[model samples]
Target: MTGSSSADQTVSDAPTAPGGRGLSPSALATGGLVALVGYASSVAVVIQGLAAVGADTAQITSGLVAVGFSMGLSAIWLAWTQRKPISVAWTTPGMALLAATGPVAGGFPAAVGAFLTVGALIMVAGLWRPLGRWIAAIPKPLANGMLAGLLLKLCLAPFMAIGQAPGLGLLVLATWAIVGRFARLYAVPAAVAVALAAMAMNPPVSGALPADPWPTLSLVAPAFTWEALVGLALPLFVVTMASQNIPGLAVLATFGYTPRVPPAFLATGFASALTAPLGAPTVNLAAITAAMCAGPDADPRPERRWQAAVTGGVGYIVLTALAAVTATLVTRSPPILIEAVAGLALIGAFGGSLLAAVQAEEERIPALVTLLVTASGLSFFGVGSAFWGLLFGGAMHVLHRWRPAGA
Candidate 1:
């Protein structure tokens, strides 16, 4: 996803005709690839995240289907209407937060309430510039610190898997490492493929698959709780905005596409809210997949790259059918094995976040506090460590800057 200034200049100088450019085979193929890669790379993490927060198999299936539909439809709408290579995706980092946070005070229903709260917050941020600005103002180091801490446990799963089941874990890790050497983008998917094959060869004790392999929308009645709001909703919103939406817009800009931010946020926020009852979490602009669709690989002509997004959207809709199968497999497998795959998928993100967390000398101490507290899994009064980490780090940051009078 790296885009240099020279590449930006190249894309910017390409052409005009935002509305009239017709679809080409290259755009179609790139779009399809984007969808396949995006889904395969992280769907395991999504399933693991849902299950962590007390979702039963049915709820997880519904979440997968709802998330797929929401991201797919919203992406198509944005790309078609805006005529830009705008992409939508479920917040991967936020899902990691869920996996790390584990179950809340009131279980899955409470988590659903937290999800709804996040959707509302996103919409409000879109409608009110100050709120969005406020979120943006959260110190990058602390934000990355929290993310790094949240990801630490899951990132260790591969090696831990090796301890738990050496043969299976090594097989998966070897596949990921070997494929990553040649093709980094496909490494996780390759590992996932190996894991799935292994699972297929030796089915879990929980034998039967769902009676119907097709995913259906299952409504979850949300129950808001103080712990859910403070612990889950707020952190999820911050992670989604900080990690996903903002970076997604930046990716588009790097590729020389400046979409209207408010509308993009509004659309995704609305989609998240509408689908929350159906068990989906927040849907927002994509960062990595946005690059895949916006770059020259998708289409040499910037004006026509929107077609890639449209096709990618269609591809997500098509892949919704696999949600039930995916959820079933995850449910039946040993949780640690599935966690190992999820961990492998997140190693890149973990490294990036950890670096970002401690990169600035001025923010290093505060950020380190945040990272340690979060990684420690400290909790109090029913609230999770994520909120505590942010709070403690933010306190340290403010204190660090609070010199008496003028130094």
Candidate 2:
């Protein structure tokens, strides 16, 4: 938490071994698990979201590559530089928003422009102290509640998938439970492996993959318009900030690690801006998966845990080469099964967030309101519910604090 350059220097100087003299086997394993869970689980949503915005297959493939590279680079740089396990990820809520909004007035190009705007917003928030501080000032309970809300539906996907594919789904859940009892860190990754195996055995009915396994960048010229900007950009920015960045910081805080905030924001913002033309969405600090790398499981010494994030980044970069192929395979799999595996992976994180949300008695009402509003999926004037949840919860908190006792 203390902003001391000497402390960072000391950690960076610490001995380690694996890939050179600064890597550990545990870190590498945790990193691989983080990358696997982050990408394999929700990549379908990204593909669908891009398609919903009228992006072609090539564009979708390119988006995946760009996003993978961006997050990988960001995670590597941030973790290594700060000497902290600061994993980065694309905003899931932003993808969901894009998927739900469908094509804007100007279509995919407009969505690209909107993404650029969101990137600029993130960069500005990083540069402008007030904005960053304002976002940071959001109450911890409310932030946790918003995250819990965002994760709740996805966390329940296992049961839903069991209804759709009972045998396989139950198998996946059973694997997760059994593995969790003995080796909690490896549980989700093992479940993901099982899910992938099931998908391989019962492959979906897609026609074929491209002969060229590589995904090429397809530049989409920006088409800015009020419709797209307001309808997409603003909401995207808010969700990325509140549901992703804020909660991400909270996740780090929970582990007693606080890297420099603006640098993290700026790195993702720059990455977003650079990749927007390739139809990539915004990359930000990871909220859910951060716990995996930051916790004691990654490394007994918290100071050395950053190696895990760097390893995850390396994993992302390696996976980027298979972006097109992976996207094709994932899209072909049964959507419910992928979601179920994702839900199983996130159950721990969801529970942690929910517990944090209601820890304090006085904060319970506001926290619950935030969770309900965010999960309600309410949108007004094109603003997503994450923003509204924070606004309403903040207002409620203010009133409660200002009111007389017992009133």
Candidate 3:
């Protein structure tokens, strides 16, 4: 994990691939199972974000439906090309960020516009190979620092929620830690599954969920407003890029797999853009969650992870259809059950990312600056901490840059 460039590892270092064009049944099954657990944990974050942004119950449902469908399609298409299990979802941080900026934008439609702007810019970033290369070339610590800084809030959220329901949150947290000991596959599923079972068994928790899960497609007419374009949409785009995609690629490299980053970013950005009006903000690659899907032990055939992603995408579409066509069906879930589990599930992933970010010797200060500013929650002049963390960290690195003539 140290000293070696995980990205530049030669083919000889990689495990030998199975002699096959696609994944075996076992790999596919493992992939699908992991994908489902990961996606389920994050889905409620989307719903909560929409609600926070002042989306009515109906508009919130519509946004989720759109996002689900877009994610499903994007994953399927990208998996077909890459043969790796890549999944896309709402930026949990970005959503939390939006909850801060979204209300000032007047309505959900404006928030959607913000999401659209983020997609367009990110797609451009994908096309701009220089930018992609530069981002990839950045020292791992600075990137990790930025990630840690950005995710600091996420790590803290579960405990905040836990104050209300110790039983549920502790259950999920325990499951997250223990699952790895038995079978890594059991961790996320067991967390989510147990949460659901607890909610079902306990009437008070179960009552929060709809008696019958029914969600219908209700479209929110997008209101084109400049505030959303600047305040909401633009900021979200930056968040997704800095806070989500870059870290996601880092996770991929950490595991010693390299794929086309530009296309992957573009695909997720485009999907988020197309679905923004419905309420889903910038959708992008998942870092920690994707790691769960990509371990060496996940499948005998490494490539079959693509099938897991495809299965997840399909499942997302089904969820979307259900959410869109009927409002109550999926929405009638116990909020704390899923929410607490997601926060708990992400705890380890967040720690791993932060650790990587701060591990570098030369980049430590910059990474620290990035982490401090990001965790500070300082928003000034309409920009958020993600931008500030990068600005401060990158600026620090540049200020210390060495040159032959200057030195």
Task: Supply the TM-score for candidate 2.
Answer: 0.82
Model 2 alpha-carbon drift over 4 Å, by segment: 1-24, 104-107, 207-211, 223-231, 381-385, 405-407
State the weakest 10-residue window (summed lDDT) of model 2: 1-10
Error of 1 at 18 (Å): 6.1
lDDT string, candidate 2, 1-407, tens digits: 11211112223333333433455777788788789778877888887788898898788878888899999999999988887889999988789888998989999999999998898889888886665466557787887787677667778889988898889889999998899899876777788889878777765565223537877888899899999998899988988987778768756665556567788889999999889999899899897678677755676666778889999998888888998777666666667787777677566656766777888899999989988997887777545566677778888788778968687
Candidate 1 lDDT: 0.76
Put down candidate 3 lDDT per residue, 1-407, tens digits, no spaces. Answer: 01222222322222234543654554455455544555555556666677766777667766766777877788778766776667665687787776565475557766666667788888888887776576567666666676566556656755755676777777777887788678664566577677667655653322112333465556656676887777776667767776677767755554445557788878987887777766666778876556544434344344554566666677677666555322332234445455565555455445665666666677778878977987797766445565677778888888767567856
Per-candidate Cα RMSD to the true structure, in Å, reads: 6.6, 5.2, 5.1
What TM-score would each prediction reach against the true structure?
A: 0.65, 0.82, 0.73
- Report the lDDT tens digits of candidate 1 across residue range 202-300: 654552235477767789999999999999998888888766786566456645676767778888998898888888988988866776677665666
Q: For residue 25, what is the lDDT in candidate 3?
A: 59
Best-first order by TM-score: 2, 3, 1
Using lDDT as the measure, the top candidate is 2
